[model samples]
Target: MTDAELPEDLARLWRRPTGSGSRLGRPAGLDVERVVRTAVAMADAHGLAGVTLPKIGETLGVTGMSLYRYVGSKDELLILMGDSAFAVEYIDAGAAGSWNEGLQRWARGLWRAYQEHRWLADLPTSSPPRGPNAMAWMDAGLRAMRPLPLDRMTKVGILTLVSGYVNTSARMAQQLEQGWRQSGGVDPALAAQRYGREMARLVTPDRYPDAAELFSSGTFDTAAAPATATPVDPAEANFIFGLEVLIRGIEATTASAALDTH
Candidate 1:
């Protein structure tokens, strides 16, 4: 579509080459893609705060204002980075053996996307998907649920739930990891033990019975576990566990509908 046909953000986001190639008199070897690529690299290394137009321009050996030729502003560059970060190879949802399996793969893909680009969790949410890659991911999610007996709206709702869950879980995980690093990089097992001990000390059974019981259960004693204990990463283990529970809940809720349709 022509730039005129799309909103200002999308027009810049979905800009295409005009066969004529680089604009006349513009510097050779510099273009929108290069500018965006450089910006994404900066964000990946130093985060969104470090990705000013001036920094991008300096990285590309040009003046800060020169970047205006490619991106309208830092906001526009963020939109581009948000889209480019999802450039991971798309997994066709149709290839799955079952709807749940397809959705599981889709959700895991999103989690991996968050893991790879932690800054995505920090970006402002764009509802209705504002870019091509974002729209493609949404389409993949819908395709994954094609086998569901639910109506389109229900399917959309499910997709939204799954997407929201992945984003929330991934964001929390990133924050926790960041906190862990900031606190002198203590071992996770030791951290868990310390947390458990502190909770046990601070929590009174009469005041908070349920949480007190949990703290008393020795569940958080990771350091005392055997050497052969499961080596799985706790963050990944929790994510997978929560995802499975969510999928099971979805399956149970839709089972009756599937039966009725048959």
Candidate 2:
């Protein structure tokens, strides 16, 4: 469809091909892709809040108002940034041996994208993603679930759940790492154990029985003092643990669906 047919916000997203088109009388080197890339870089180095049109223009050696010819406003630029951040080439989800393997690969691919662009987790989901790259991500997830007996909505639901899990998990990890760096960059295991130890003092069984039990179980202590140095990084280990749990849930749902059809 042409840009004219879509809503204003969505039209802006699908309007110009990346780096291919420029407005008349625009600067020699500046284009949509370059501007978005510059903003993405700013977010990567500083943060999402650090990316302003004026800052990007200054980096590109132009006036901020001149950028209006390309992107309409800051909100529109954010939409571009959200789409641009996920510009990684996704693995073909249907190629895997099973839906389980296919989805794991898809989820990991998305996770890697988030890791590369930490600011991505901070971008608010103003509306359903309509950009080419964003739609491609959803398409990949649906492809992975194509073998399942479930219907379209079920597949979409699974994708939404997995996507939310990866985004929130990445955000938490990023926040924790930043906090750790700010607080002397202690070992993560040590950090976990210290938090547990401190919580143990304030939390009581009367008010928080489950939490008290968990704190008293010495789980954090074991993590802090593993028997041998393991090759797996703790952050990745936690990620895989949660990912496998979601995969198992999806597999169970598929199994149920198959049984129902029999």
Candidate 3:
């Protein structure tokens, strides 16, 4: 195909060139998947900034400039990497039994995916997803919500909400975990005690009565806090709580829509 006629991301992902002449001078052994995979490994090891075309080429035992023959640009490579990284098996919503169950499974699966590939949360969001795997994931979520009495836009909105939540939560957790590790891996109880003492000194009851109450309640005492009252891992607990709230909102909205139609 001519440069102007080159297929976009989705089409480019699956389309094969017509002949050896279409190789764009790419090395005989190099192909698109290997190029994308090499970039992914580089990014996983050293973040997005480390994934230069040169580095990818070096990793694959080729000159870095030659990588351009296979992948057009760094931006395009990133899009491919993200699509490849998140390519998941389609979730069987039928097996999930109910809309709620299906959506819950879908959301949790997405959460797990973000956790497993924390770098995904760092990807640039300048454009909407258009890659094959990205579309497949979107299709899976829509299928999960198919039984609901909701419009197409509403279903898309729900998927957006869930994806945003998962990405933000995963990013925050990854940052916090990195910070914790950087701080010499301090004992959680000791860190909590020090944090409580600092807060008590800085936040007096006269200036912050609510803060004082929380401090006095020993809510910051990681070891002493009741399991039933607070999660052992607050980050994870927050994600679960937020996901449930989103699901409930979807259910309520769909139920209301159904009633209005009757």
TM-score of each: 0.88, 0.89, 0.85
Which stretch of 10 consecutive residues in model 1 shows the poorest summed lDDT? 16-25
Model 2 lDDT, full chain set: 0.83
lDDT, model 2, position 235: 65
Q: Report the lDDT tens digits of candidate 3 across residue range 1-262.
A: 5634646444446544523236555667778888988887777788878878877777888998777667667777878888888857534445778888888888787777776666889988867767777878888888877888778988898888888988898898888778878989976556777788778778888989998887776677754454685547666777898889988987888888899999
Cα lDDT listed for each candidate = 0.81, 0.83, 0.76
lDDT of 2 at 84: 84
Cα deviation of 77, candidate 3, in Å: 0.9
lDDT of 2 by residue, 1-262 (tens): 6545566656667654433245567889777779988999999999988998889989999999988877878989999998988874744544788888889999888888888888889988888768988898888888877888888988888988998999988998888889999999998878889988998998899999999999988888887776666666666667879999999988987898799899
Q: Please identify which of the two predictions, 1 or 3, would achieve the higher lDDT against the true structure.
A: 1
Residue 104 lDDT (model 3): 82
Evaluate model 1: give its lDDT: 0.81
In model 1, state the lDDT of residue 139: 83
Candidate 3 has a TM-score of 0.85
